[model samples]
Structures are given as structure tokens and as C-alpha cells.
Target: MSPVKPTLKTIAEISGLAVPTVSRALNDAPDIGARTKILVRKIADELGYVPNRAGVRLRTGRTNVISLVLSTEHDMMNHTARLISAIAGEMQGTSFHMNITPYFPSDDPMKPIRYIVETRSADAVIMNQILPEDPRVAYLRERNFPFVTHGRTRWADSHPYFDFDNTAFGRIGVEKLVMRGRRNIVMISPPRNQNYAQNMIDGGTGAARAAGCSMRVMQGTTSDNRNEDIQLGVARHLAEFPETDGIVCSATAVAMAAVATLESLQHRLGEDVDVIAKEAVPFLTLFRPQMLTVHEDVARAGQFLAQAAIQAVRHPEKPPLQGLDVPTG
Candidate 1:
């Protein structure tokens, strides 16, 4: 013998409500009173009720799922992990749940988006690593699909997004180095194809020009490269540009690689050369207290993206939400 599976009728019977009212409460219907909804949901949880996806879709034509398409190439050191946790936390106790879909850098970014839209697998999508004129954005827009991006594309004005202000980060980082009397500055940016890369380059170059300092973007490798490759690349760049006294890194891993390379060359950190980097968490100081850093708050971005995604699915007729977090010293 086995225990009976909990259903809507089971919850309704326990809560002293009709089946329809219980269903509406569980679905977070706006007409349902908050107190009644809480009571119904409490009973449902006590019964360990799980909604059948097929039945729910048949009735509402919605899967009540938000798909998060993330890149496997992202920094695994607390960056992507924090984002995923925050998004999941935000979706807790909500009508919707999150479904993560990961893709490698070598794979086409559109594959997951296309599959989700074509199959009606998810009600909305959330993604990052945006290009200036991303095809995924265009495709989703054309189909009138409800989606939100963690980073903005060229057509950002028309979509919902929550992005860190990388341009401001670049400028601020350069200004910090310049204030320390460093004239020859170089930045290790992301790939040129990324939209934020251009923003960072523009800000750094513009700030250097204003300060009358020589600034250049490192060649041959991006912040996404492996640690060993980045260390070797930094060493080569230092050999070519010996005057490089200040280094700005786009990622924490890049900063670590740069520091390792400098250390091998008998350069004292914060004395021989200053290194500034951006991080999602505040552990960089624990690793190297001498390093300079700016916080990017990936956790906040995740929460905002999740909220915007839910809003888009529930109320597409309303205005899209947009947020930009500027760098803080």
C-alpha cells in the first residue's frame, strides 16, 4: 500500500474551499484574497502537493517556467553561482519556477532560445553575455516573446534588462590608477565582440586621453582565457609594453593572473605596479589586500532579472523594466 498523491481536490477539501478557488490561489490569481491564498497554499504544502505540468498547461496554456540561458564559459568563481542562487531565491514561493539551460561558448547562442520558443517550453527567458546587435534579441522581439536580458544589446531601449555599468567601471578604474601617479595604463578587457567590451574600451580610452596618459587594450587574449594563458599573455604584453605601470582587469580571474605574472617578474604589487579589477563578490581583498577593486553586484542583477522576467510573462502590456548599476568605489 502507498499514500495517495495530493491533488487540488485534496487541498480544497482540507482548506474548506472549492476546487476552483484552491486552483486560483495556487496559481496566484489577482482576484484571490491574500489571506485565503496563504491558507490554501499552506494546506497544499502540508499535503506535499505538486502541480502537474501537463494539466496546468492544458488549462492555462502556460508552463509557468522561466528559462535562464547561461553560458558555461562564465567565471565560475562566485559570479555565475551567485547569479543562479539569487534568481532561484527570488522565484521561491512564486507561481513560476526557474529552469537553467547552459550552453558552451563554441555552441550557437540561438539554439536554446529557438528550442524554448518553438516548443513553448517556458513562458519567458533570461540570458546574459549580450552582443551589440544580438540575433537572439532580434528573434525574440520578432516573435513577441516575453524575455529579459542580464546584459543589454543595441536595441536595449525596447527590451527589459538589468546590466552593470561597465563603462563607468572602466572610467573609475582608470581614474583610480591615474590618481596613484600611473601614466602608462593598460586594460585587459573582454572579447571585442561583446557589447560591454566596447563600452569598457571607450571609457578607459576616453579617460586616459583626458588625463594625457597612454592607455591601450591588451592584445591576443581576453579575460575569458584560461589562467595559464592569461598569465603568459600578460607577461608577453609587459615585455612589449614595459612602461605599463597600471593594469585594469575586467574579471577577478584575470586580475589574479596579472598579479601572478607581475610577481614572477619581481614586481611588488601596489608599489611596482597597481592592478584594479571588478568582482561580483568581495573576496578579492582577502586574496590580495593590496589590489584595488570595484563591486558589480551580480546577485542584485539576478534578482532584478528574475522579477522583470516574471513581470513580462504576467503583464506584457505594461512597460518593460530596465536597471543599470554603476560602479562604486
Candidate 2:
């Protein structure tokens, strides 16, 4: 015979609590005392009790799901994986679960958001790759949807977000190069349409001007381009502007490509051309001990985004939570 499946009634019987009390405790009801909740949850865990999502949604009008809409163009080797892991870990054992919605760069960014909203598939959404005036942000705000962004837009003050201070990162990267007596610099930035790209460009440009150095933002290619494409672009740019001695890269992959291009051209790293790059993980230094790096703490960003998204769903009336992480060293 098959083993018995655990249910709320089963947990109530095992814990010696009424069915309604057990349900309330499991749901983390405000009225339920802490000790009782702990006890009920412990027994439920031991019994392998899983809530019926259909029944719960039917009763509470909440799907208890959070959708994470990610772009396929992100750095798959480390950044994307770490972010997904962190968000999943944050949602574990909570009343809500996470669903990943992958979209291509060529597709409309609004497609997934519309599907989730129209189908009532999730109670909240978490997304990245924000623009200065993101249409998705505007749409969600107009519909009063609960969402949190990994990057911020112009209307960040009116919504929830957890963004790394790319502006500061850009400035710091340039300053580090300038301190080392490297004058002419080039930044391998992201797409011009991205809000963070502009922020970084502005900061880097301002810093270079203040220091009496020349800085240029590379054209025709972005950090999100393929490794070979980035390598070619870097090679071509270096060929045209051989005076570029200090390089700033927006992502790890971009840095790797730039370094490779420099190596191919027999340029000595740290001595001939130094590179400063942003990374979510600590492996960039391991890859090239001579290269300079700044950590973005993408895992921490993921945790913050998860919590902010849930908060927006549960307490829409409260002030939105906003977090900005500046670069350290």
C-alpha cells in the first residue's frame, strides 16, 4: 500500500491542535502566537505536509507565487546562476514559491509581465535590466502590480528596487586607473539604452575630466555581446585608439575578452594596460591576479529583491523599499 500523504488535518491530529488553528499557524497568521506556530510548523515539516496551492489561492485570491523574469543575454557562467540561487534560497520554506520566466533580448520585455498579470499566475514579480524610463515599470505601476526590480529606473522613488551603484563603480574604476598613472582610458560599457550604462558612462566621463585624463566609451559593441564579438570589438578599438592604457569593463566576461585582446596584441597586463571590472563573484581575481575588480554582491541583491517583492505584495500601502549598493575597493 502507498504511504499516507500529509495534510492539514493530519498535522492537526499529530500536533493535537484544531484543524483551523493548524491552518492559521501554517499560514503565519498575525493572531497566531509564535510558540504555537513553531510547534505546528515543526510537526508539519516532520510529516512532510505540503499546502494545496489551488485551494489556498481559491480561498485567499493569491497565487502565492513570485515570478522572476530574467533575460537570456545575462552572464550565464556566474552572475545569472548566483542570482537565481540566492532568490530561491530566500523563498525556501516561505508561503510563496518562485517561478523563472526567461526571455530573449530580441523579444518584447513586456510579454512575460503581461502574461503573468493577465493569467494571475503570480502575486509578485522581480525583474532586472532596467531602462531610464522603463515601460515595464510604468505598466506595472499603472496596474498597481506588486513588483521589485534588480535595477532602477527614473521612477525608482515610486517603486521597489535593489540596484548596485554603477555610477560609483565607474568613477572608482577610472580613479584607480588614474592613480596608477594610466591616462587614456576606455570603458567597455553595456548597451546605451540601459540606465546603468548611462550612469556608468557619466560617472566615468566626469571622473576622467576632473583628473585631466581622456576617457572614451567604446561604440558598436556592449558588455552583453558574445565573447568573440567583444574580443573583436576590443581589438578594433585598441587598433584605432592605441593610446588607451586603462580599460574599464562592465562585466566579468567583457573584462575577460578585453584582457584576451590585449594579450593577443602583446600588451602586458597591469604594466601596459590595466583593466578594472565589476563582478558578482570573487573568481575574477583568480582568473587574472593582476586585474583590478569590484564586487557587486549579486547574491545579496537577489535576497533583497526577493524580500522587497514579497513586502510589496503583502503591504502595498507601505513605503516601497529601495536599496543601493556602492562598490567597495
Candidate 3:
């Protein structure tokens, strides 16, 4: 004989709760109390009751799945496991599941994006580090693929995105340095193709003008995404301004090279220079204890991208371009 399959009624009866109450708890409805929710879920788990997500989606016209895409090879290089884990953990009780797809230039990035739209890889989509002339965005929007961005775009109002105030971050970073009595500041930014880099430069420039200091904004190599480009940029800054006292780097990868460059120039970490850095990964084991830390939590950004994409898919009319600032400590 086949095993008995559990349903909402069966779980509700076993848990000694009303079917409606059981449904709310199982579906993660906000009205349910903590203990009731816990008990009902425990009972459902014990009875092996799996909610029919497909059935729910069918009725609601939603797939409850999201697609997250990384635009650059550097993101692939620093594919943090913590980001995946964090996103999975964030979806513990949500009705949706997430799908992550990676597309590279060499792999014909456009091909995968096309497949995503046609094959229904997900109901909604999320992208990071978008190019100024991004065809993927235009293609998806033209076809009405509901999506969100981890970073903002120039055409942001017509689309939905959740991004940080990176411009403000740059201003704050540089301003902090200026207030501390450093005049010449070098900001290590990503290539111009990336919106974050341009925004950071604008912010730094504004802050520099306000502080009456000289700010030199330099670019990282777009090709290969190597540390050498960052190294060379830092080397230029070091040689150009031996009296440079403060630095702000967009990527932590640059900081690793910056540390090397600083040592080569015989500059002390705290006394000779001060730095404010952003990173997708957390700095857990820095030998230097005094570095001011700003954790970007790219992994956390991945999860947000996942959620926003699903929302856009569900309600195309209310596609949100939140531009959220994932707070850093």
C-alpha cells in the first residue's frame, strides 16, 4: 500500500488547531503568534506535510522563484559561500525559493539571460554591477521581465532596484578623512562601466571641494579584474602624492594590494595613512586591529536581490526600485 499523504486538514487535526489557523502558521502569515506558529510547524514537520507551492502559484499567477545574476567576473572570483548561506537562511519561512544564475562574457552572457526569460528560470530577476549600456536590462524590460538591481542605474525610476547610497558612502568616507586633518585623498574606484564607481567619484569630488582638499579618483582595470590593476593604481597614487594621508577603496581586493603598496613605500597603517574600505566579504582576521571597517555584505545584497525580484514578478504594477542601503558598521 502507498503511504498516506498529509494535507492542511490532517496537520490541523493533529495539532488540535483550526484549519485556518494551521494554514496561516504553515504559510508564515504575520497574524500568527510565536508559540502557536512553532507548535503548528513542528506538527506539520512531524507529519511530513509539504504545502503545495505549485498549486498556490498556479492560483495566484506567481512562480515564487527569483533569479540573481552577477554581471562581472570579479564577483565570480569572490563568490562568497557566506552569501549563498545567508540568502538561504533568510528564506526560511517565505513561500518562495531562489534560483541563482551566473553569466560571463566568454560564456555568451546574453544567451543565458535570454534562456532565463523564455524558459521561466524564475518569476523575477536580480542583477549586480550593471553596465551603463546594459543590453540585458533593456532586453528584459522590453520583454517585461520583472526584476530588481543590487545597485542603481541611470534609468532607475522606470525600473525596480534596491541599492545603497554609494554616492553618500564616498562623500562620508572622504569627509571622514578630511575632518581628521588629511588633505590629499586617493579614492580607489571600480571601472566607469560600473555605476558604483562613477557615483563614488562624484561623491568624492563633492566632498573634496567642500573640504578644500585635492582628490584624485583612479580606475581599476575592467579586463581580467586583477589585483595588478589595483596595484598599479595605488602605485601611481603613492608616487604622485608621497604626502597623501587618506585612502578610500571601493573593493577589498584593492585594499590587499594597497597594504602591499603602503609597505613598499614604508608607510605605517595608522600613523602614515588612514583608510576606509568597503568589501563584500567580512574582514575577520586582519593583522592590523585599528582599521575602520565598513562591511558591504555582498552576500546579504544577493538575498535582497532575490526578494525584490520575486516581488516585481508578483506585482508588475508595483515593481519596486527601493535602492536600499544595506547598513554597514
Measured by lDDT, the strongest candidate is 1
RMSD of each: 1.2, 1.3, 4.1
Give candidate 3 misplaced runs (Cα > 4 Å).
1-41, 47-62, 75-83, 219-224, 240-243, 280-285, 295-306, 319-321, 326-329
Distance from true position, residue 289, model 3, in Å?
A: 2.6
Candidate 3 positional error at 185, Å: 2.2
Per-residue lDDT of candidate 3, residues 168-286 (tens digit): 77888888887777898888777777787778789889999998998887544332357776677777867767878888877666666777778777888767887777666656127
* Candidate-wise lDDT, in order: 0.92, 0.91, 0.71
By lDDT, the better pick of 1 and 2 is 1
Ranking by lDDT: 1, 2, 3
> TM-score rank, highest first?
1, 2, 3
Model 3: ten consecutive residues of lowest lDDT: 71-80
Candidate 2 pairs with clashing backbones: none
Error of 2 at 303 (Å): 1.0
Clash pairs for candidate 1: none
Query: How many clashing pairs does model 3 include?
Result: 4
Q: Taking the tens digit of each residue's C-alpha lDDT, what string does model 2 give over 1-329? A: 99988998898888899999998887767788989988998998888888999999998999989999999999988888999999999977567789999999899999999999999999999998899899999999999999999888989999999999999998999999999899999999989999999999998999999999999999888998999999999999999999999999999999999999999999999999999999988887898899999899999998988889888988899999999988866
